[model samples]
Target chain A: MSVTVPSGFRASGVVANLKSTGKPDLALVQNLGPRHSAAAVFTGNRAKANPIIWSERVIADGVVSAIILNSGGANCFTGSFGFQTTHQTAEAVADALGVSAGDVLVCSTGLIGVGDQEFRDKIINNVPAAVEALSEDDDSAQLAILTTDSVAKTATYAGDGWSIGAMAKGAGMLAPGLATMLVVITTDADLSSVELNHALREATRLSFDRLDSDGCMSTNDQVTLMASGASEVIPVLADFIEALKSVCSDLARQLQGDAEGSSHDIDIEVIHAKDEHDAEVVGRSVARNNLFKAAIYGNDPNWGRVLAAIGTTDATFDPYAVDVSMNGVRVCHAGEPDQPREMVDLTPRHVSVLIDLKSGDATATIRTNDLTKEYVHENSAYSS
Target chain B: MSVTVPSGFRASGVVANLKSTGKPDLALVQNLGPRHSAAAVFTGNRAKANPIIWSERVIADGVVSAIILNSGGANCFTGSFGFQTTHQTAEAVADALGVSAGDVLVCSTGLIGVGDQEFRDKIINNVPAAVEALSEDDDSAQLAILTTDSVAKTATYAGDGWSIGAMAKGAGMLAPGLATMLVVITTDADLSSVELNHALREATRLSFDRLDSDGCMSTNDQVTLMASGASEVIPVLADFIEALKSVCSDLARQLQGDAEGSSHDIDIEVIHAKDEHDAEVVGRSVARNNLFKAAIYGNDPNWGRVLAAIGTTDATFDPYAVDVSMNGVRVCHAGEPDQPREMVDLTPRHVSVLIDLKSGDATATIRTNDLTKEYVHENSAYSS
Candidate 1:
């Protein structure tokens, strides 16, 4: 497995012993290139992790040499000690790569505020060995950044003369308006940080931010894109933007597929809303509805929950003006239930809800998954 | 099973056949002469049930003589037909009691958009028999308006000069900003419509609106308070306000206890917020958190989910200024983990979350329940 082989970068994953499960828990990625431009998106959660704070400051410079990521400890709500640990981890990575500490971004996920001095020491001591093992063909870096994920997620897309490859890790702690997914993208395109940052933000807004599985956001959610300018032929900016969105959308779908305790992936599409904001508001409300998700999990195409959720939004549309279609069957029309719920079979792994507001032409789409007993079991049983 | 034995009201429950289960599905209550002053609260959900629309308009006069309620099928999203059912139900109840139809209010709850011609016919035919059976000892009225509830919910508080008794039915479709708990209170006190309405609004804002179990607000939610004036001794408005709040609080607690698929009752208390709105915003955010609910269900004291939920709120406060206590154990403080996860035990059936915002004197409390597999099972298995 290789994480950076498709781009102008080197990466490595190491065992840091931060996790009691003894899995690969540390990863380092370095942009070994002449043009080092970067962009990032952080969690909107106010209680951010220490690594997010550190990485946000570092990524503000529009260039980064390396990113040090670790699993098992979120380093959030840890007071000054957690902040120090994030700083120390970044400094260690910077020292090994001979780059300024400010140029080294950091990210951590797992148990919040649990790492102690011993854990910090182990991470710092392993930095030299981790850096020495760095290679362009190492994909363990992506694997190391996983916490409750059952499998590693990776997506690669090739454009005219540029390439975009990305990886993410998250199983639970998912919701709308951004979830707990951590994404890292490497690209060999000649784009400025301003352009890359704008594109990444817009893409994420339409993709990852639309996912609402359990309506839980983690403190350490981060997405970073690095441009190494290795491609000689420049691709059109529009094509690059489309490719980026495609990659993010693919990763978002993969995350939904691997959602913890999820038996089905549900896509909520709101069309003909009064405006884009209203569509998003309605879409998110439907995405976070536990009853709707459970209905899908039970293979019951109950669209009443959809109506109830839409009723909570500020969307400018009469509830009576709405139409709901589930799995190609119209379950509701003009606000009243019209079709037999039995006609819509929901046992499939994927379900779609198309809500026509009968208002304006704005639309928004949200990706989510059904809630299952296994999700409750896994989340409740986990100590963190 | 007595619905109005504590006060000066006549009540009855009848089989309207709105449900396929053939259970007693309609309830009627008359003030039985004296002060007909009334106050009511409807669901905040923008997409309201048709009965809510009818009741909201009729109650504006604050001179209601009767309230007609039906369960098993919520007359929501039925468009004009739904509105007509509510109107016809009110008319039937009024004619049976030999009163004006405009003086009677209506409420309905259950599956949405399923109440059709058959339901309307059932109400029209059975209401006369129900009115003849009206008695203070009729407990069946309380039992009639139930869907998935495990038990009937009723409460009574006797004052010096007057008595207040209330009944409610809700198990699932519960969330903050008002769950689907239908409540009706009767008191034999002489109070003006202005005073009664004010008291009812204040009581519900702090009580029913604060209970969020599954974060799914139902289309059919209502709380009505009727003053019969059987007790000639009129008390001060302040005393009546206190009594109303007490009844609401009691009903709210019962609703939480009866939450479907819930094994533990969780109370989230937000203190030292900028204002009541801010505190409630933070409290509801935590109450709707699936991760935190799952953690409580698993008996794992994962307070990180609490912090993450609070982070989603726009309340003015530094994340680092927060302190959280689970049950009696201090788990987090100053935005960092304060106690070992092992030290915090969640074995008790009741859990408490105390969050100190350190912002102001205002505080708010929300009642919720842990997410369980049974909740998912019940919701998913239930048909439209």
Candidate 2:
């Protein structure tokens, strides 16, 4: 159903004056559970945000009772004061929720190097009202944690006894480095924190880690999985892992679809490589090729750019032995022209670009958004 | 002074019908010299163009009598027929110049996967006319190698009894994996092939290799230096290297200035890194950041994007100890805001961004272009 559909969870959102537009800028999600346990992943970028730096330590012991998120400032590279802002915000949230300050996770997204003392004070003062308004049916929490995204992203995959629910927010700086953006997934399934960590890693490794809508990696990306253990039904690890991956993949695709100013969402599948890593290398190269992405946006089947992108990688493939297909019409065969470029229809929102290395039996798929004039305009329009 | 300024060199350009625009599509530069020696560098892309494959072996012995360059067809990934086309083009140039095919270097630019039979015929059939029209004062050669470039890039360094001249063509796909795009530099100094190779490597290492305009590596990049040795002056090695580097750097800047659809030419300087490599790592990371580039194009002093960009690199630096300056105003100090955002003016084409790593004394500069709507339009307008 929704993020709040999971057992023993309540969410609410309030206007904290963090954003000048007067939109909801503060959000809270609490685990009112029989058992409180969580697993989380963060952006691998070394220069992380203050919130990420704080939550990394908070999640180390694998217990999280509440989460506070904001979309006004990333609170990244904001110096020691910004760290204090993140710390005090978590403390305020813990006080409101009757939880330990160390057991709260904080997430932030917006312009980098923001979140000064004034920003911190606004979040702390509004936290009590956000906590008082918490309800299982409130839909505003998901609306408050978006920076540039035009739509809210949420997904659910229910099993026979328990269900997993997820929410994410990102439209730019979406790249693959573990979690590409800020996300939260809640479940009622009974599982230990260790099992949740293992399953989260495997799920995100195959899902969010493969979604590279843009080549820009954010500094505040975090994906946290909180389990309430209120369903009283322990599921098989294999099934739980699959369900978690499905939800993550759903959110990943939603993020890709809402990428900033993108005209088309491209799925680059690199197959027949020497190994899975080689396939991933080739896929990422294609994903990062601005020329190829622009051509896709223009509905032009420019296979040469694809080959040129592939040439950038160290994947095992003879230059003359690779093949490329657009929408199942082979434009390049054995590194030469196969089908005419006019036959490939690319007007749809979803585009598939398949590259065959003809080296070994391995495959990888990378999700990306096409580079368009609108994307350029949207990203360059304002400071945010 | 132009590429023809070098002693014992003649240049000309002609229309071979290779380009549909009927512009000059073929260019020739010959060394009618007493001593013929040369050095060259090709693109590091694994899938190289046919001309690159041919000229690599032709310049093996460090002797080059003439060069035949064409626009409107990169002749890359055109299968075996493209290789044959390059081979035949060299032979045709050799037949017209009264030299061995092994002594002629061939260069091509334009769309990849071209150089089919018709395209190759246009080149092979026009060699005699191009040779007959060769004149030192024709000055059409530089105009022939341009594709998508708003202006021709040429530079000359006059010295005591010796000179160096060069011409380059690239508005896109200008990344550092060897010298990006097509360039030919001629020198009249009496240096051996070994000395020329060493000097060329050292000179280009600091110039063309530091320009990363669009972060797209080309498949047909070539930088060739032909020494006529006509001016029998054996200049000091260090002085000649400096002058050569000056010309290369001048050309690199011109390419950056004329980058496709760019309104701002961004110069990112990384200072106080651990070493030159670390400096380069930090500088290039900032140069390749689309968010930072877009902000520059928007005339916004968004220093946070700069910090976020450098954070992606593994260069030795504490994130909190960094300082970023825009147009001489320190916008960020100790990873916090310092100067006002309105203090920086990006209305001019030349924008300077300085990042102080506070790690060491090493420094490096990277030249890049801002991403704009016109860049997206031009790149997506045609298959090239």
Candidate 3:
């Protein structure tokens, strides 16, 4: 009931034999509304997938009729043929929904460099069935887009007379400038595409853009927001943005909790930074430090690693004036060992590291996961 | 025959009881100088260790008489007490060698935050014993500086009437700016301290500064070059720089080979970039990418990950115009799959990734190691 919690949306999941395990691998979400306004954000990676290239153009006109996504193949680096597959996917969706092909978006995920004739044929042949199975109450579309994710992530927010619903799928290759995940959000508010775009950028900047698990960007990441003006509540811009942020934040945490091969979900919160950018830079430096993550995995409470990691960043902070607290224990104060390391226990799955820069009031939190042997093994065996 | 391979230098290793294994953990290298001219480089990390702070000041006058180093403790983030320990150790070395305490450099490695009164007592007490055991032919100093390294790393370059010998110790926390190792280079060439400084900087910029094994910067990294001027041969600056570079490059490779838990030593060479900086940025981006490293560890030639990594960098390269070759097989040509991945065999320990940016003639190569399960386990258990 995630995306369907809002009115004027229909979604469906279908099996396309794309995944070798015979799981549902294709999904379609349609805006059955009087207003078909939309906005999107694609991966910052220069080497983008074909679907991303197509979807970027689809959102350029501020109008979208439907979005189609598939798993088990990224359709990246497949060259002109792969681009044709994405064009064909959008065309198929347009034909099924009786809309222009330019208004349909496409997304694909799995392994990179996989789009071939067979892959195209399966997606194209299964479109009608996916359209036939569309219903407002069906939540199976959330399950179709997952690759290595352990669970489906979805959230909904109820406003005065409007509502926002969202779904996200990501397990690895997560980093800043947006995690390697596909997000589809639907809202039943009477907002223009420009307004929706502004709200989405504001919301994702604080939520999805702060997750840096493994620090790997993907070629096929995208976040799409579609608005259908069935519930004719003209929401305040500030109120709509706040509601959207809550939904995005809820889904981002779910993604962090389910990151691949992770033992602990860690939050690196930097406080008293000179600016928000400096706070984010310091937090991300620690988030991407493998030594810090591995120390958390071993429950070592090694606060020196925290300092060592932040030392690499050019954030405006005095090295000797910083304080670090792990799990509420001030293990280090003014860059000197304060409490004994044994006083801090990292056995819980949720770990928090607070760093005070003693500069200004700006603060930021970056979410990451502990590095483990299982992470190496899973990534090594994935071959993507 | 490492540091003592050159004339006018005496080195010794002594048991300090600082190491739990009771092996030789303290080393001293003194310039029995006709001329004592020296230059050094310390870790660029802002949160530096006590020894790095001491050595950076000692090398300022370009007249280091002796250098003392110890393993089993890094003496970092241990507050004012740690600085006192480093000062005491240097003073003890100066007292034994009859030189100024300001002229004696200090270096420490092993775990961070371990400096205490007991640590100081062991190191200070062992200085005289190390000085008494000094011999020009004994190569024990190389073994004394090793922490987790399986074997000592040493190199020698004999010039026209002069010679250079160097020893380095680093197994992990290797990154740009410098590897997490202590290095001492000795030269018999009659050169000024300024000349040695120029040569040392130029050599290290291409050698130790290009190794990015784990992308973790250390707080105690230092590289020192001492000239004893015993050969009475005033060598050309170009020839001296070349000889120093050869020795540093040899030891850098040895450190790369002995990187902790690494299965493959990867050389990511980026060619035809707009400039050397762009090439290095692109190469280091790939070297530090965990996904690309894990793929190499699994013996999979996943060239798409290579493109994804370089795409994240601001380097001057057209994303679609890049070509990636793994071990001589061009897996991606012009950003599209050319040779099948099966054609590239990655089972060998030495793997080469050649990325042709097709933008300019400048090039650079970054050395790294494949991410493996053993790497995660080793780092997780190390606690520092």
Candidate 4:
């Protein structure tokens, strides 16, 4: 429903022993087109994975012919050997797809630290099978990229003469050093790689970058955008950018809703700040506050926890002049108690927290999730 | 035996119906001093609690005759009436102890935002009774200042001429905006307010400020040191500072050990950093990482989570040249896998992690607790 939604993309997922569970772990996306202009973004983390290091250089020329993905081994911090493995995997995919090795992007997720020899063997042996099975079906690619996510995430934004479609996979480690996810977006909107980069950056700034789930930054986060220009119909760049942003936003929301073991999806709308940076600083401080997140899970409209988080930031705000609202209830007005907390209902899965810093008119929003027992349980038992 | 471990200190605790548990919640500490010199540090948060605001002003005079503490409500964001409650509590303590009102300090800890009128009424009615029960009983005062802690924490350090003793209480909100603790330290070493301030600052900098469990800075954290000068025993100022630091470090460890719902007490010893600040930044980054904490909870030596967290910091280090050791087993050597993870054992509640940044000679240690289901359960079900 994603890559194929654009005119010239084929994808497939293949089962490989790369995953101990023997689930589908290899995915291939081939862009067949008159123009294969592409743009990509990688994790902000300084400790990058092997595939990330490889793909960063591949996307430098703004051209990508095919992309390869695997789950179950991060291939991060595995020294030079892991880097070689990533390079070889891309080479194998390039050979099978009849594309240049330099234009093949690779992404891998799952366990961090070591890339097991057995997993590498499986990936090497299975790359050709994934390539051979590639079809116009995007579902397999979407499924293969997931780690702990419970559902496949795909979104489409249609325009007059073109469309933007994307598939994303993420569950835990959802903080803004790109939130531990692999994403592939496809569009046939007759745009150059520079335009694709501009639109991708702008959309992600307001989407995936603002979604902070558990405050853990991964080393393997990557988002790739491939434009085939197969529609041969050009639309206004501004409108196309808007459509691209909608798709990114939709996928970001889906990731938030499916965050590992979370019960409530939270959107913090920070308003009236000195500047956009101040607004984001305040919002992220709140988003990373485990106490505030736990309180939300309890259905407790604990605005003072919000205040405590606000105080931790250098954001421009008078502590006593701020106001906080949970849902539609003004639990705190001007930093003091206002409506009763009981007036706010938190039985639903979606929670909205509004903080008015009352310093300036600037605003920003951050998406997060309520920390729950299941979250701790899942994370604690995961490694075991 | 906290306050009275030093000379010229009398303390008492009484039930004030402040906490719903109806346990001891009010405490008074009086100094029978030849010189009433004191030093204090308050939470760095901009959202100051009522008691924190009052105590900051009182400590500026460098004299404090007594301190009043309660552990039911934080008196934060509770409007003008909450400020009045703090003022009235301090006045009551001063009146009962026959000291100047300006020389009395107050501290409160519990739920934030709403300070019930009934809680104020009970505190006002019970202050005189606590004063009447005053004795050289540091044990009672220690118990009165705890909220969710499983035990009252106390530490004593003996010097050649005098001794230093302290009591502290903290559970959640254990990030270092001075670590969300209400602490009162007493010493009989004859020193000026300036000297006491210098010693206190130095001691807390390496001790209390290094403990970061949940990364949530609190609004009501306060640490105060009162010198009665009754012993008139002046050792070298440096030796006195060392004794004070020992007491602070001991109490800080006890706080970490008794942190609510903690299954493991972790000491992240960061070595060979660019500076002490870099060491601390790197250590706290690892300490606050929930994924790493959860991995420890499961007894899984997931060194990659540690690397992922370390990569988030700006500490000077070669990303590929760092080493991480868990429980004396170097699982990650120079950012690559070293010992088999199964060689490390995390069965003990006390876990030590050594990270060698390999940048410089400076080092620091951060104290934390593993994220566990019990923590999430306690925090989630706490409000009711």
lDDT tens digits by residue: candidate 2, B1-384: 377888888888899988889999899999888778899988878889889999999989999999999998999989999999999999998988889999999999988888798999999999988899888665789999888777899999998999998998986433443223888899888988788888888977888788888788888999999889899999999999999989988988888888888899888898999999999999888887777778888898888888777778889999889999998899999888898888888899999999999999999998889988888887788778
- C-alpha displacement of B216 in model 4, angstroms? 0.8
Give the number of the best model, judged by lDDT. Answer: 3
User: Which tens-of-lDDT digit does each residue in A226-336 have in candidate 4?
Assistant: 999989978798898888889988888998999888999999999999999999899998988888888888888878888998998888888889889999899998878
TM-score for candidate 4, please give it: 0.98
Model 2 lDDT per residue over A291-379, tens place: 88888888999999898888988889998999999998999999888889999999999999999999999999988889898877877
**For candidate 3, lDDT tens digit of each residue in A1-384?**
778778999999899999998888999999988889999988888889999999998899899989999998999888889999999999988998899999999999988879999999999999999999999998889988888887999999999999988888886423332235899999989889999999999998888888888888899899999999889989999999998988988888888889888999999999999999999999998988877888888898988888888889889888888999999999989878899999999999999999999999999999989988888887778865
Error of 1 at A288 (Å): 0.6
The alpha-carbon lDDT assigned to residue B179 of candidate 4 equals 31
Clashing pairs in 1: A77-B336, B1-B139
TM-score of chain B of 4: 0.97
- Give the poorly placed runs of model 3, Cα more than 4 Å off: A172-179, B172-179
The lDDT for every candidate, in the order shown, is 0.83, 0.86, 0.88, 0.86
Candidate 1 per-residue lDDT over residues A189-263, each given as its tens digit: 888888899889888887887877677777888889988888754668788889889998888888888988889
Which segments of model 4 are wrong by more than 4 Å?
A172-179, B172-180
Q: Give the fraction of native contacts in model 1.
A: 0.87
